[model samples]
Target: MGKKDLLSTEPYKGVRDFYPEDQAFLNYLIATFRGALERWGYVEYNASILEPSEIYKAKGSENEEVVREQTYTFVDRGEREVTLRPEMTPTVARMVAGRRRELGFPLRWYSIPNCFRYERPQRGRLREFWQLNVDIFGSSSLAADAEIIAVSHAIMMALGAKQSDFIIKLGSRMYLDTLMQNLNFDEVQGKKLLILLDRSSKMPAGDFERELGEMGVSLEMLSPKTPPQDVLDVMERLKMMGIENAVFDLGVVRGFDYYTGVVFEIFDTDPKNSRSIFGGGRYDNLLALFDDEKVPAVGAAAGDETLRNFLETRNLMPTYLPPTKVYVALTSESLVKEANKVAETLRQGGVAVSVDFGEKKLSDQIKTATKHKIPYLLVVGENELSSGTFVVRDLVSGEEKSLSRDGLLSFFLNL
Candidate 1:
């Protein structure tokens, strides 16, 4: 028999397979990340996965280029053209525009979304992946930018990340345009240069030179790489309002037309990974493209799949998988509801409790407890019920403690 062709029948590439182990860990990771975001006062929101193709086309955003270049777009049976969202900003913008009048100033919205793009899948890249999108609408000040970056830092720190793990390489749309316009470059030429500049770090110096030369750029212009001193001095004053670590990089054009100013890229500071982790910037022109009032916005979308790999590279996630703090067990089936009642009571005390509903041997119950890493198991049965007392077993320490019905609540609360 001849070798079969892949397209004839095969699983789609660039998707994921979440086995049980992956499911458990992913749940824990999402919980930890969301907990951090919520602490920053960012409310969760979601948008439709399918959006009109023109939504991206209007501002000529990077995603629009990707839509023409890499999106998995198709026409519906009704001939309605739709595309899977490659990013979330435009969808968010559409939602904002619909209710812009009612929405108060400085809206903070976040979403963990599954976005798609059709392209060559590689390590740290996938066609389908989840991202953490942090957006601040109606704020144009540098304080908002600082808060965004700081929250990103906080999330990383909460997830056991360190400063040295990544570097925030900042740039400004105003700075870039001011320099390019100073060189007498028109908007058309400036955009071409930006497309080239976006690859500055990726391509070798000679390749970068040739690529620019092919576009009528010169070696001398590329040599004095960053913006001139006076312009940078002004931006430095502007950047001071942000966190001290934010830097001005001439090479960071952000590859998105919607970014009007204060652009930045986040790169891995560790030598092992030098790629950009994520990028975002202020976009003041996007809403204007919709004929809606210009609403200044800034946000970032971090690829969770990419970040998972980065964290895994650094062994950054917590171990032991957030062990169950409480497990309520019915030593006899007769005490099912009682065990559940005690479990609920303990849970209300801010403890994580699991109830055993299976009719199994007590040994089987203990085995289940040890297997699931439930450190504390609460036992309720006839003798304990009649006496208004309870038995608790600490699986790891092999210690059993008994407490009165009144004391059970305090016992678990203290643990």
Candidate 2:
């Protein structure tokens, strides 16, 4: 049947439905991310999917853009404008600032949660997704930035991605601002120019050139889109300051207006499909907008939808294809109960085993077991039941043997 004819269906387009195989991979990927976070000495926390609009507005932010631009928003029963959260950092900052007095200085935390963003769907980008957000709060030193970068690099590495498959592109707002100063960039004009630059690779060269023309640039074209100066001068300073090769790109000025210090993004090395795999930066002023103090913060989040595509592109997704390990078939009506008992024993031994209680014939049962990729099919027939044992048939090897309870357990234990 066609999907539209159904009474209800999935409404979201840039979302997914993960079944057994995909779920297995998802679980594996999440576990890997969690393990890496734990090893890096980070604690886990969560924020509600809904947040008050005021939290965003306090820092010269727009709930309407989130409501009208990026998020799934609606008027609640009380008619207050509430939004299903499109990101976690803003909420995290609110929670930290609210309890700032009680929490210790420099809180290290991580969260793996569902996030939403309404954008044009494509490979590596989606509206509904899961992301891992790691943060360091109350620290202003460069070490905090380094630790965040290291943790992000570690997560990518854990996912079977090599240094060549991914690159950590670090751009400091401090550094970028310094370069702008050298070029006499208007702070107002630069912001517009930066917005144009963000779309440089996304849109066509001709369109970007035209937009630059509108921005009062006398030069029709720019080398790498930053005219009147060599690109390497700014990059060379970063290299001189000991920034790793993992850090590149002077053109990355992230879209979020809150970033105040060192900022970084992870990008796939594939030039053709190169998109930011993840991005984050320090926002020391976000909390100060609400309170008296400048509460410093730095964090990063990687959407798994994007990360998954990055994995698939590089053939680095976790291998977690699922199948049964064992099946116990009741070959005769008299042996059915014993077959259940045998299956339970195998399960207790940490073997994934299923028993046949269906009315299918013995031949059909065998076919079903094989169809599910069950490795071993145990046939507990009347003859075997009388002998206090069962026939263990290795589905792959096609070898049969008479094995007692102890022998079967020992055999499975070895496997």
Candidate 3:
């Protein structure tokens, strides 16, 4: 070897390379999410993955680690610093503010955007992931909060998940703020307490208590037996709407300081995958960062990674079916044109068809179709072309049917 090759087959350390099977599952999850959101009159929206670096630096809006370390930021050719978005909320807020007067109030928008973060990858946490961000803008009512939660519940149910599959843990930044004030803690102390409480679930029991003690706060103050009235009202409203899984859990501070009111997180109930599937809360002031008038908003983001984990743990993942419903295999090179014609007829009848040239043996072609999991296979030979009829075999079952041109069109149309 004159020169050694230095190329690596691995994807970037923290990101993913979604092969066909992985992409099929991702598409299924996205379709399920889109259907649920659209049923609620939520229109889809998207933004460029690149944004100015300052967007993440907005006060009280993002996690510090996201800005200082996790973000993929670099100076472009023009010497302007750009960053791949670690989240979608700031960009969505910017869009709303840019056309605040033009857009209708109480707008429902949803997007499935890939976000990047430079962090240690674990079971559910990845460096790169796609998240479904659903939000209702320009609504301050607790009903808006409840509707957001309801949409999240709807997505779970749409994916064949039962009510018992997950639990909605409700919290309130406003309630925590009130408690801090009542306890005579200042803003700095309150911020520290919120960060601690947010990490409490992941921290060990003794270490968590010790940190709170060092900060002059006690565990009882954070996890009161009775939840605050607003949190209770939101949970009750969700319950009234037949979402029985909603409950109050005071430990959900939602990491971001911008969450002003009711916050909620959905957790997988299975012990094996016991982690947060996704969560969001009321960020009434996020829009104010752009304009003087604040548009009260509540939204939730569900990640494909965590949701897939939940479905896999519960055995609810959908079976992958190849997009091609029928594969047309040529019996020999002489019949390639005839096979193409047959595939065209099937396509005109609204059937997904793939034509295989006769490079491989006919038996090998059928094996390829079977290996791809295509449900139906049609072999076009000289006799079938001369007779204007073909045999279609169901790959799943060993069932075969002979049909004329019109009959073949009707068969798939009926299916």
- Highest TM-score model number: 3
Q: List candidate 2 stretches off by more than 4 Å.
A: 1-5, 8-11, 59-63, 177-188, 203-245, 321-324, 332-335, 370-373, 394-402
Lowest lDDT block of 10, candidate 2: 226-235
Model 1 TM-score, all chains together: 0.77
Native-referenced Cα lDDT, model 3: 0.89
In order, the Cα lDDT scores of the candidates are 0.76, 0.75, 0.89
lDDT of 3 at 368: 94
RMSD of each: 5.0, 4.3, 2.0
TM-score of each: 0.77, 0.84, 0.94
Residue 173 of model 3, lDDT score: 89
**Order of all candidates by TM-score, from best down to worst?**
3, 2, 1
Better of 1 and 3 by lDDT: 3
Estimate candidate 1's alpha-carbon lDDT, on a 0 to 1 scale: 0.76
Q: Could you tell me which 10 consecutive residues in candidate 3 have the lowest summed lDDT?
A: 58-67
Q: Distance from true position, residue 118, model 3, in Å?
A: 0.8
- TM-score, model 3 to reference: 0.94
- Which ranges of candidate 1 are over 4 A from the true structure? 1-13, 17-44, 61-65, 106-108, 138-147, 178-192, 213-220, 223-244, 320-324, 329-352, 358-361, 379-391, 402-406
lDDT (tens digit, per residue) of candidate 3 on 278-359: 7999999888879998888999998889999999988998888999999898878878887887789888878999989889
lDDT tens string, model 1, 1-415? Answer: 5566434443489877775556676776678768988998989999889988888777665556778888878899889888999888888888888889898989999998889989789877889888788889998776676667677766666777676777777666776687677778887888888977887877888998888788666767554566545335434654564434455566787877888777767777766666567678788777775655789998877787667777887888556543468777777777788778777777787778888884998788888888887788777778877898777888989999888877877777676
